[model samples]
Target: MSRTETAARVPTLATVLDVIRERVTVSRVELAEATGLTAATITHAIRELIDVGFVHEVGTAASSGGTPRRLLELEPTACYTVGIQLDRFTATGVVVDLAGHIVARSSMAGAQEGEPAEVLRFVADHVNDLLATAAVPKSKVLGVGLATYGPQDRTAGVLLTAQPTASWLEYPLTETLSEALGVPVLIENDATAAAIGEEGLGGARSSFATVYMAGGIGAGVVLGGQPYRGATSNGVELGHISIDAFGPACSCGNRGCVENIAGPTAVVLKANTIPGLADRLRLRGDTVADFERIARAATSGDPDALSILEESAAVLGTATVSLVNLFDVARVVIAGAAFATAGPLYRDAAQAAVDRAAFMRFAHPVVVELSDHVSDAAAIGGAVAVLRRSFEARTARSGAPAGR
Candidate 1:
């Protein structure tokens, strides 16, 4: 959409609401300053928001020899958004509020072998089931957000050729889900969504990158307090980055891709060749379960499992080093389904690699850490995606994140 269209959709009232959501609670004076709006404008916006039950007067703050200032805060229970992550092996979903809290979550096998329409039908049913199970009022639900693997055409909410589903190529996901649920549906690349999730709920201040490892490897970059959605939001393909020219082929038509070398699939494959490792773990075909079992073994001092994890982490670290060089970001978050079971190992290796040899080590050190919600990052991101547009407007007006 064009700038005019965006401005038309997001009015002053919506922007003020975003500021209140971001601040959690703030005085009108603080909202005015943070949102770069006049006091009268703030007052008008809050009046409208309060009338809608989205915002309310929480109490007065201490006054400095003046009238006590009435602080405003979001009525977090006013509405909810559903965030769902469709992974190759599992579908994870969560309900989040304006305050970015996970009110409820549910997960199930993704069944990669199923037909696209059948799988989507299951997804829609699961979404409805979640809301019902959580007892969230239908009237209070705003929209649904989906964070799936790329390369997808985010503008059209269509999935292109990607890891999670081959049958979903050219699928009109948003339209399908919207029709199913009778509300607006937003689709985002899981990597990008995970980055947004971390920014909103994780401890990150604003600028950072999230390296998401799951069914496939990818990344989401946030710069200047906004997600850097490359043309069409299909921009970053971290997992497809070639690490070895003669290495194994990847679905993205690349040689020796990071996904091929460092992903859970690779770890499972490598473990199969390790003496007695596969048989000992009763390794089944389920990649997610395999990863958890192996990660646990490694945690228990199994040398073979530890070796697999080390190899995976080392390769991930090498890729992250390149990302740090290209973006000059001060912090990086390792997130997604892959990291869910083996986070510390990846964090340690990636951090060591960045601290030891990152190009800007002398100027500014990078902080590598695990995601606050490892496997659920993308799903939570889907929930927050519903509210992020307003926050973006606030940032545009104030030239910074609303709460910053």
Candidate 2:
């Protein structure tokens, strides 16, 4: 559909809520201006939101000469959602309220080497523990959002790839999780989820790209306030982009993909070749943990570790340039667990690369920064996905344009 048609179908309430969430505190006039909705429409929507306890008046903004405009903000505790980022090596779960604040979080072993049913049970248990820790009853939760690696059918809610194990292919992920958790479940790409989560967190540009690194590398682009999901909703697979055609074969049936060359797994493998570097750093077999060790050493000025990371950063920077050129996003957020230890290096490398080579650098400076919630971005984004889905459902029911 065209952007106008897409915007026309969005519910005004959802669009208004999004504006309030983005602006933190906005007046009715300001909301109308931001969303391009009629003043009467904004008033009615704000009334409905306030009546539903999703929004509340926070006092009045100073008026130039007439009546003071009442300020409104989200009522954070009005509802909650659970977001879980499940990968081969780690499972991070978080409970977030309406305002996108994480009230509680938990982490444990991933679905690695487990049967599908066993992994589902493990995730359910973790989610149960998370809600209990947050003291939130199940009734208040809208649903759960699962963020993971993809190449899957989101509409069917099944994974298509068999990365960790072949048994996961075609597994009824959302159905099983919903049944296990006693709530609705949604699945999203990890990188896309992170981008949504970043937008929900209130300080991001409406259009930007999020480069997420976990067990692998991926990117999500948001353009004109909407996520750019390609035909399959599995777009922007940055990791699989080949930096070298003749270097090495990647599991994705490609040669010299960036991930195989500079992903955590690749970095750790390269570090291990340094004869006792792994032993010196106590590198376990875990890709995530080992890479963190290497990153830490790099930060501590270990020459061998530094060299490995610098090489990886250089490759990632090259990839970043391509991403910027493709999306033309003025801002790039480098996020995920992989960057938690050595984020600054990647950030600097990406920034320098953009400054030096981006196609739009002469016209507009491209900003690159690390996520505040680097390690938990996908998990948090998973939570935000639940809220976004709720809004979409509401829009579907209302059958109205979102307006903004």
Candidate 3:
């Protein structure tokens, strides 16, 4: 074909593949109808995908007319991706297939609260272990998707700010991980990853916007199915967004930032000081699980525990109200180890605040729900992130992925 002819021809092959992959199964007639392409074109595209191992003939569909149609499904195991979630204290690695299903996962404890190198090493170790246990073939694996707390330079794949973490300043995360894993790496903020997970696999599947409430106070904005990762990856740092300029000094050097008033550390500090609450909640363990137990106690009517949680919930509610007003989000998904403690209380308070204070209160009621997957959401999201990139980059259509 001539260059001009080739240029004039629409490349709908990838589009058809993406739809089939996401839908999991479809008949050729359905693909033709979905793509607005002729039956011949659909046949050609399906043949190409099948020859390349991207699609397979799963089975015959129920007959609608004279003959049963063959159902085509994405060969999910044909490709795999790695995902990593890096936080202040530890890192998690997960492996997932083309369809965003987790195949294996591994985690390791480290001083991620300290420095980037320490945390990156922890991530690498976990990745190695996950790959080993899954016995994934290297040729079939696509790449890695990394989720981190950040003021990130997404294009440069670097963390732009000096964090409490040692050596976190302008760190080359993607390059380093790519060098170590020998695969392409895509990096995104934790909230962004969580938002994508929800977009791709969670409650937000049908919603255009969602708020991912997590480790620190923040919201992920997905407008029209695409995560709006601002000019910098530092978008929607609700934790740093000020609600009370003079209330309390926040670690981010801002007074009364949401994180200072409502983050896990802040809640723990406030809860521990309460009289009689410490013994009943048993907030003495090293893990966030311990804090969750305390929150559970508060939910069960422990007065002192309830007071501490209520106070923190008030702060979180205030911050959430501000976010709801700014974005008019359709749904909010609250997750993280902290929320696991008193998620119901936090969710109730947050919804109450939004109902009372959101600027668009009369438009529609925003859905507020807790993330059932908890910490696993981030890890699962990381995997989804890779599959998402692989799909979009190859197909060239930027589709918004629902949360995992």
By TM-score, who's the top model here?
2
Tens digits of lDDT, candidate 2, 23-73: 899999999888788887788678768877999999998778999999999
Expressed as tens digits, the lDDT of each residue in 98-162 for candidate 3 is 66577897665634356666566657767877888888877877888887777788778888767
152: Cα error in model 3, Å: 0.9
Model 1 ranges with Cα > 4 A deviation: 1-24, 32-48, 162-166, 389-404
- Measured on C-alpha atoms, candidate 1 has an lDDT of 0.81
Report the alpha-carbon TM-score of model 3 versus the true structure.
0.83
> If both were scored by TM-score, which would come out higher, candidate 2 or candidate 3?
2
Worst 10 residues of 2 by lDDT: 1-10
In terms of lDDT, which candidate is stronger, 2 or 3?
2
Clashes of each: 0, 3, 17
1 against 3, candidate with superior TM-score: 1
On residues 249-275, what C-alpha lDDT tens digit does candidate 1 reach at each position? Answer: 776778999989998889999999988
Candidate 3 off by > 4 Å: 1-24, 28-52, 66-68, 206-210, 285-290, 395-404
lDDT of 1 at 252: 74
